[model samples]
Target: MQVAARGPAALTSGRQRPCRPACAGLWPAPTGLSARCRATAEVEADSAVAGWEEREERGTRFVAGPAFYRPESCAGRDLAVLAAALQRKRTGRLRVLDVMAASGMRGARYLLQADADEVWCNDLAPDAAMHSTMTYNLCTAAAAHAEAANAAPGTDPAAANSHASNASTNGGSSDHSAGSSAAGGGPVAADGPAGAEGAAARRQAAAAWEARARVVRLEGLTRDVCEWDFPPLPPASPDPEAGVKAETIASSGTLGAQPSDEGAGTSQPTSSSPGASAEGRTEERPGPEGSAQAGPGPGSSAGDAAAPVRRVRITHADANRLLTNCFMREDYYDLVDVDSFGSETQFLPAAIDAVRFGGLLYLTSTDGFTSSGKRPERALAAYGCYPRATPWANEQGLRMLIGAAVREAAARGVVLRPVFSLYSYHGPVFRVMLRATSSAEWESRHYGFLGHCFVHGDNYTLGWRSLAGAVCRCDSRGKLRKSEEEPQQAPADASASAVEGSAATEPEPSASPDEVKAPGPSGAPTPTSTPAPTPLVVAGPMWTGPLHDAAELRAMAAEAERRGWTGTGLPKSAEPGGNRAKSSRNSRPLQELLQLLIEEADPRLAPGFISVDDSLSRRLARPPPRDALIEALREEGFAAARCHLESRAIRTNACMEDVLTVAEQRLGIKRRR
Candidate 1:
């Protein structure tokens, strides 16, 4: 509050209290500051409201359904991730069955994002399944809500009745039936009979024992939580006074049609990390603030559930059997993921069989493929696979060792076309991406490892070759000498020709600095020795896993050993001296490398360093020696430079018996339920 003040000019003129002289560029507004402040506030409010409206419209379109209820069953973004991947592949209207659909979040999200012909969410846990069912029901209810909102104030009675009836038919009950009916069609038909029969049998058994065997199937419009016993929605509520008003706003018009975030203010910081330059350089710049909001918690909202689906199924089953059956029946899948929890040595054949002749299969694991320790043939004998040595480089050797299975598939007329392959972030998991198009393209991609390098490109290296004539027969342009072969010529020319041929055929010896003739001080050229060609080790195709038969395994084993292409239990240094010297020369910190592998493969295998205990058993179970640890990691197929430090230290710890206590979890290996 202020009293009425005198004019600034009057004060400055010394008519009242002596005020300091006004500063340059300072001017009072004719209407006063209060009005300006009010105007600014109003404008800000308008902008905020407009932004929110825009977000609401976009979000409404992107996220479908009544997801406010059953957030747990509705949330978890895995479905979105899967859906996005499928969309990129241009797959649509998939028939999906989430066998172990925990709360059905993944399936629900798929429905929201992709146009799925059918989605069947099944879970052994009744409560979780019912909660998921509620999510589906709410989605239908929301559609009805929209329709009711749009109805005119006064409409014809018959028209209204017919509309209502149609809505009822299109409601919850109809949705489920439609899903089931749609699922009954499509590629899913193959698995449906087996799955549905099993489910029905189980249901029958439960009904036989229980006195009350009532099954409550809800309509799409109204959720029957009481009958199904679904989980309750979150208890927290939004602020009533601060609720958002529903109003249309202008779109931000992003190219990808991404929704605008209304709650985010202009002052908020952006969420994306600074992008790297083409050459990987970073350009730093300050950004805005308060842009990102905390995402909804996992298992929280059904809005994520509507979308189309692609065809691919993952299950805990023996790959050998699964693939054989599918193959025998001429049933093929576009792709198969064989990263089981344990050893997949016996399942290679199944993978090959299940995948179409030209389909693709992704195999990952942390055992035989990593090192030479497990004889490729012997390790895969249980399933029947083999490998052939063509040629390979040192680094290429490591990569091939982990990707042995993919290579083996190629050997069996399953063309191993790599689309994308990458080393696992956590451990020795080797991810090999291969495409198998129907039968015609089923051939192995030949990879050669020789000298100190691995060549992945398509070309074979010819072993050391000798030219007919060595010395000066032709110039650098590869010209042939015109000299004719004289049967009766003197031996001198012959000897000279032999020498030249030998010189050309044999690799030129590495020249010492002193041996090189320097150019004259003015402008003469210097003469340098021709460098010797680096030696190369050829590797053929390799079959390391059982391809549905024992005979195949035996063949693979014999071939792997004969060619020295087998995975060594541990990696042996190519250079002189043992593991320790190699570690230093390779710039591979043994401890760090091992640590990183274990963390990626299974961190829980070795938790943390513990003090040596007094127990006799503990004393006897000292950690493996450093050399042994190095050998172990190398055997597992980890790059020498990639193992982490903690793993190495733990391996040699006094109390270390084993690093991987959780042996039950190996990627691509089958595990028990």
Candidate 2:
């Protein structure tokens, strides 16, 4: 009974269906429950979180209510998983901060699939706490169920649970474990187990149930849900004793005093409750010297001492203010993910501030209008760059967003390098992963402006100082034409002479007398001695750096391959029962897209791509195939590759003239005049 992935329409058709058996172990839908009971339970669960539907991806099940569930964002989630995996690979443990948690699906998946040690899922909505807690409960319960099933007849229940836990903790196949048993295709015989296996199973189930009950009790005791604003706390005053107290707390691993209940809504977990024994419950007390001491709360058998307690803290507060607080507190994270609805510019400063040097920041910007050049005024106002609406607008948008982030970090004396940049057409947003560091030697060399000539398909990038005399190769009328006089050969050191030679060799088919203009007071006239100034449209202060770190992308690709996430050689059990085909389809594109990005990621090259067709549409009767032009350019010893920015575009290290010459020769088309 596999449950396939369905769209929003199918989900809201008002038809009630029974929970599939395969999905039962991964969620709270028990096998013994009747169809009506299952439906009722699901409804009750949804009611707790404002009617959000439950969805599964990569074998992790999470609830996504109408308020935060966006189908178009599934690709973003995939990238998040990739980032989490990469971080987990680099660091042994993962601690994630999901600021706008919504249904907490992203955080839950990180915990379940990315091997996250702890996740602080935060959302401003009061019900967010309940939603995240419920998600956690479901996942833990599923793990417990798998543990009971996997236990051998004579195995100790605790030992079996430990073995089952390894599968999830190692970021292996928890979903497959559940599906094998719950889907009714496993080696375990459900009814024939009055023997040792049955007893072990019963013990396992009891332990699982107890764990779930304990979580519920803790929630009731602490009132995990709250509605609050997170404002930046004031800087701490210098205290000579503070350092001593902190050192004592670090050594002991415990808070000196019990958390207050005044604003927190409830008291701490009581010692007298059921399962409150030393092995099951934690206790806190102040040290005799009045310094904070942290250690295992009251719970302590020598065996339990080996197992460290993993703590997860959730707060209802403004994400921006929380980031600011973290910055002020000098608290840093290895990975900071900021997934916002609109522009992420407002939060970039604090986010950058909160990350440790060399840490990663995953940012999402859904403000297409500003980043895509649809509103240049707004783009300049927000990102401090003029985004041009070109055929490769998506690429420009992503670069503009990165440029803004780099500028923001630089102002605070931080250097950021983009490790990966993704522009999803479906979301119409730009997502980038950048690594941050502190460096006083950072200069503005990587920052510059782009000069483009639409008529001749010529473009130039100039540094801040060079921009003063930068000019487009086209004439004033926006056409490239040969000079009537023989151009005098200037000294080899003269750059202006080289520009003139390049332009004079190829001229426009038709020319107007008004095309030529005298040079301005800024510099000497063109080497061709044209009377008129060159026509150029400059756009920049944009990022002229590589959008991805080649080494990092290659590692990610390898990780994807190792996980069988590249849509090839996946185990039958690894597929998420109903949506296997869809999942495979999605993964294929991601793999190809990654390959394309890798090929185009050359930091030494410029940022924008050239549309071969668009450039030669008027000059030639028929434009040559993209591959033909790229091949020709490569043969000429120029670095050339198909660009991911546009379908018929290519990115190359060759100058505009070189590119045009290759295209003209490959297509057997003469340049117009």
Candidate 3:
């Protein structure tokens, strides 16, 4: 109830309670805190909304004090950790940089779970309170890593929590020093004074701020989380202009617009852990033979359990500045994870630039509305392509995001292929893991426009240069209406057989060479009139390729099982049969989701999917059985697979006509009375 009273100031003021504070200084606030934040603040768990507290994920503990952390969205994190671990195995080393690391959870896990050699965790906070909270978590995470590394073989991994407990209870070494800098400071000079003295003061202050940040990086404590070197506030003066100009120092914080969050992911954290489970999981990473090293390079490894210690540095800067600095310095990271609130389009170029050759870029987008065609103009501005509503809009959201990155990389003569793409309903979040590649297809056919025809409930993918003279065959409300001349109607009784016959008899629709030719037969210079237009709700220049890299998904699933995150890492049953196959083994949501995504990678399936409950599927007398329909699809030699974006939907190559036919004959879907 006191949220309005507390606002952003509460977390920044040391004297005030740790009521939820906005990290506004971390980024600029042209308007104010986001609506998603407001709604989340309203319904947050009673334990969390009040302030700093401990939370556990993937066997690592971190504090959630000033930044927002939702347990529901941890599915994305689970996959990332798996990928980072794989990267380490492939390259023999992994260095990570996590930007916007509010609670430092992801970065901490990178060190503990992925066994990275080093991790730079950043949340460049704008105020003292948020900074201190983040510092506490980072220090505790590092210390926990140290203890876990030193713990000998055959010891219970859960016993490792005691070390972090001691660190927090002991006051983290510099609590008083940190508090004094933030809670008690002399009035800062508001405006630049005349001449040399003022200039010298500003330089001294900037130098001191740098020194402070550097120390915090090395030692991980005593950080107050304010702007580096700049005056914390607009100044203790009445000059509004001075305040406005003062913002230039931290301008990188607001480099991009406020991103849309995954509204679905913000549900109150109720259960101990909603989507993640620890059935076969352990907190320990054993070394070769039996003895584990506590440090990397010479000693322990950077993995879950008390494997070893890795170099970890905590930073508080906007994402762009951090990545850009790396780019300029040619100091690239093995993995760069940017978990921004909304569309990650703004950071694509810079993110690509900062990654070492062949490294991965894990991107996210929560603007489900934009991809669903609610904001075409905004989508264009962000992804360099427009989004139009379609039956598979959720999947299009993934394609839209990938297409943008592909193009961005193409501009630099590089290619990126999806290691895996995830669409979690929790936040309606769209996440994609892309890796630089060679021998992968990025030609025009793989990146083109997609069209959905309302007239026939059909979808098409066409190249940008080939849109001319294209026509929808069902323009006349007739299947494959090959000629303009109206034809005789068929009897009602034969319609069923006719419906099922097109799969074998008629060819799929395409630009008719005869109709598309100019008026003269000899290829005249110009044509007098053109064929009638067929309207299509179109979305484009997006990735029309496979959603997941089959090899990568398989490896991740195997890794999940090896790490005890899942039991089999395989679905209990996903057979293309009549009965719905059971999901993954109990308490393994990550495995279940991964299996569904794996199914979506079939090359035979096209760029669209149909909801099992939509009118197309209802064309049968009864709602068709999902597995039976999939089996029917394959029996007729058509491709079919379930899409993870929606539970009851399938992506297949067979046209709707064949689907209805197979439903009628194989699935026992009777014709309507």
Candidate 4:
């Protein structure tokens, strides 16, 4: 289920997979599906979209399909579960948030599929608006696929039935109390005053909102497909006679959504803000009067006027400000996610206050450490959670605190569920998701940890339990685990090997006191001889040659020192008689490395040169020396000359591969070493 690749490969399905992009080459396959179903899942062509949707409607919830975004934290399991939860909880329309909304792909899909009452989407950058637009376009494409599939002979049955059911359900609508303010229709007005100018502004805003909303609805088309129609956004409504104005609807662009029913307009679009620009790239939408109508596309006005409803506005202001000022009021949000990248605990109490009673505060704590060079217990205490270190052998100081917090919350009648988790690529960063209940629990549990820099340049969990506590507590085993575990031992070995191979060379470890050579021989003073200092020797010319430029050479030596190679003996000529000896000593290792590199590349260069392991193998395998690299280098006519230089550098203990790699990097060569 886990995939790790150091390079790219062409799969049997003809997808070019790149190691960096990670998921760039995968085609999601459904489990428990027959051959027919599996074939249906590989519906990459635009033509197959319709058929795929038809099959998807009948597929079980567990069925995995090709996803545009399926990373651990961004998409895949977490997103799927979230979507299903939204659907199950919604009575009429879904209220959703796309937090870290990158390009709005996920939100756009939701708009296209779910019957959302309102959706709010926000991002850290302005360029995200373009992504929002694209997501909306894709959603439209998905919708079209659904419509087309249903229109087909056999696949159409399920869609037709669902449509009929939705229509009937929409017809008998009551007040949707359970949904957010954006969902159930309420007051609809501009935040400004009522006047000629106000009305014009409202109209402009509405027109813009509708325009972007329509773009979100047009998610069915690929970039190649042309749009059909676009509805103009409506204007904002004026304030009441008492000078009270309501909030306007959030932009569909924010969340990249359209009307859920496609036929009805009851759902309020909240995925994105109206200020976003779609750049006019959506499939055609049928206008009110005609089957197909279009204008400047995403910005065009559909030319319709209707009074709007009032709705609670969604904005991206600082949560601390909102909560402290009481602008949004307590119990305003059913679910509030304060996903601060560094620390979410600072806003925990405020978030808990914002959510309604029995609501969920999905908070993330990425700062996992304790004070005084240990894990603190205050994190769990703040959230009404208690630690239970079962199988005590598996418990660490920091982990115990987390477990304790959950247990404490449970004791206080707070249903705590530890959900999805992820570790950063280097394993230094860890993200944990927890669902908390009750304001008291949330307030009490809000805490932070101070990290400790341990020996060997490693960071170990350490923090104070609380203001009252002196230090964090941990068992002897936990301390040993922290200090003794050779977690980085393998990586260090790999690095050593890489260094050795590049030098055509050799390698080491361990030491003894006798080998170390203590000061005295047989407890007697040992005589020493003073050696003459070597003079400097430069490689370049007199005026420009580094040898003559003492100052420059000194500067170079200082620079090398800054990079951890401390010493004053950098210039070969700095020591007169020993200049060549020192240079040879330094250059010899490099030559050895180059030799090793040449040896590694030899099989690829010479057709008849068989690898010793390859020769001994009983099974048939491709020639060991034949490599794509050799072919690529030869195609460019640099193979023979470069190989000769490489071989010489390896044999002479001079640096070759580094130089080659530098040249390749400088030239921006796509080929890998």
Put down candidate 1 lDDT per residue, 499-614, tens digits, no spaces: 11111111113422122111111111222553433232322223211111112122222322322221111223321124443433223322332233333222112111221121
Can you write out model 4's per-residue Cα lDDT over 94-206, one digit (the tens) per residue?
A: 33333333433443333333322223333333222232233232333233323433345233211221231232111111111121112211111222544333333322332
Instruction: Sort by lDDT, best first.
Output: 3, 2, 1, 4
Alpha-carbon RMSD, each predicted model: 31.2, 15.0, 18.9, 29.0
> Which model, 3 or 4, shows the larger lDDT?
3
Q: Single out the weakest 10-residue window by summed lDDT for candidate 3.
A: 171-180
Task: Compute the lDDT for candidate 2.
Answer: 0.48
lDDT of 2 by residue, 1-673 (tens): 1112222121121122322221222233345888998898766533433432323444344434434655445546655666665554333334466777676666656644454434556665654224333334333423433344344322221221123223321222211222112211112212234443433332233223223321111111122211111111111122233234334432432211111111111122223322322211112111111000121111111112111222233445578866775554344554678888788788889888766454568888888877667788888887898877655577777877788888898898667777788776655768888876665434355555655656556555555655655565444321111211333322222222222211211111132212112112212334566654456566777775577866566656655555545432222343323235543322334466668778877543455677767766655556668888877766654566777656677876554655666667665766666
Segments in model 3 whose C-alpha atoms lie over 4 Å from true places: 1-50, 153-309, 438-443, 474-534, 567-588, 671-673
- 483: Cα error in model 2, Å: 20
Error of 4 at 528 (Å): 57
Q: How many residue pairs clash in each candidate?
A: 106, 15, 16, 91
* Model 4 misplaced regions, further than 4 Å: 1-93, 109-117, 127-210, 213-340, 364-429, 439-673
Candidate 3 per-residue lDDT, tens place, 1-673, comes to 0112112121122122222233222211124548887555434422222343344555455545557776656668888888776665543346677877887667766655665555667775654444444544444444443433334323322224322222211111100011001211222211244333333332233223223332211111223222111101101112232223223311422111111111101111112222221210101101111001111211111122221223445556668866775564344555788888888888888887766444568888898989888898999999877888787888889999999999887775456778789886756789998875322334334677667766556666655654563334332222222111334332222222121111111112242212222111111122235355455666887987778876567667776654456322122232112133353212236677778777887654677787788745546676787878887777655667787887787776655655666677677787554
**Candidate 1: segments with Cα more than 4 A from true spot:** 1-317, 342-345, 356-359, 372-413, 439-673
Residue-level lDDT for 522 in candidate 1: 12
lDDT (C-alpha) at residue 306 in model 2 = 13
**TM-score between model 3 and native:** 0.62
How high is the CA lDDT of each candidate model? 0.26, 0.48, 0.51, 0.25
Instruction: For candidate 4, report its TM-score.
Output: 0.29
